[model samples]
Target: MTRMNYQSARFLTSAPTLAQCPPDDGAEVAFAGRSNAGKSSAINTLTRQKALARTSRTPGRTQLINFFTLGDDTRRRLVDLPGYGYAKVPEAVKREWQRHLADYLRGRRALRGLVLVMDVRHPLTEFDQTLLGWADDQDMPVHILLTKADKLKSGAAKSALQQVRSRLREWEDLVTVQLFSSLKREGVDEACARLDAWLADPEPA
Candidate 1:
């Protein structure tokens, strides 16, 4: 198996709905989180690009499934799923987004794993648990990033990580949790290692 060159990533396409997504022929790991959870920032940081994934002041600006290629290969992809649970979004629209997210998670064969981002100070909101339930139904492996770790004191951050891990102990086999700070660039290497494992070609390369 070969590890991908994440820094070589470039914008591939964006699909307003899952049906419009690119051909599902190769491994892809998706980043998902609620609005303002630092998902886009993490993606940008991971790819070592200032704007690989757009960081917006508006929390729910990402309304599409954004796709990016690993290096020059279209087969290896990184997906930025729509940000969910924005309070200002209309309820009907929120439901529609949830439907599309559910459809993709349940049906996307190319999806290898999910990187679930949440603010360290507010990890595992209601929608986050809902997302986790969907992942459990699909038997999808998840790596939980307690992002914005720098906002809390060092001891507080570690405690938050421990709490998240403890809360997810039942899912230990399919879920993992770690502290991450996009601001401090902390845990970038560890996160990339998980991505490497998930994005690596399963068959002989």
Candidate 2:
């Protein structure tokens, strides 16, 4: 498996332009989810860095595609997609954001897989389903990370995981589901393992 260790964030850029993305190297694994999904915290936790991916107190702070290189000089790009579902953003701007997000999701040829982070308390939502549908249409591999698992009791967390699994299993398209707790440092290795496995696999034709 390809070992993943966050080296540093090279730069942060908008999605419509990919203004900060590194030149094409191998493949990019993107993190996509709603605002306040604990994405930044989870990313920092996974990388074992306290403040690698900036955690925003306000939702929708990340308005673009933020790129971070992992490992050494020969590093893979970790794309942090802008958070969706914030009602405060203007409609016109939201649509424009969607346009950029859609363009990336629809056109990025080197996209290997997606890390779909959902709040464990809420699991999946309508918007989440739409994103999953889009990924299914593209035949992209998706790994769902149920974030904030530590907030729940052990039994509750297990039950939620099963519930999410059953719901995903019902879908015609497949997805891998895992629990994560960035605050408690739980499941970080598991998340990394999934990423490693994908990185080690042969590229799709």
Best by TM-score: 1
Give the lDDT of residue 117 in candidate 2: 93
The alpha-carbon deviation from the true structure for residue 121 of candidate 1, after best TM-score superposition, in angstroms, is: 0.2
Q: How far is candidate 2 from the true structure (C-alpha RMSD, Å)?
A: 2.4
**Alpha-carbon local distance difference test for all models:** 0.90, 0.77
After TM-score superposition, what is the CA distance of residue 194 in candidate 2 from its true location, in Å?
A: 1.0
Residues 1-205 of candidate 1 have per-residue lDDT tens digits of: 4556789999999998878999877889999998889999999988989999988888987889999998788888999999999747889999988999999999899999999999999999999998899999999999999999999999999999999999999889999999998899999988999999987873322
**10-48 per-residue lDDT for model 2 (tens digits):** 544434454445555566788988887888788777777
lDDT (C-alpha) at residue 23 in model 1: 88
Q: Model 2 scores what on Cα lDDT? A: 0.77
Residue 15, model 2: Cα distance from true site in angstroms: 4.5
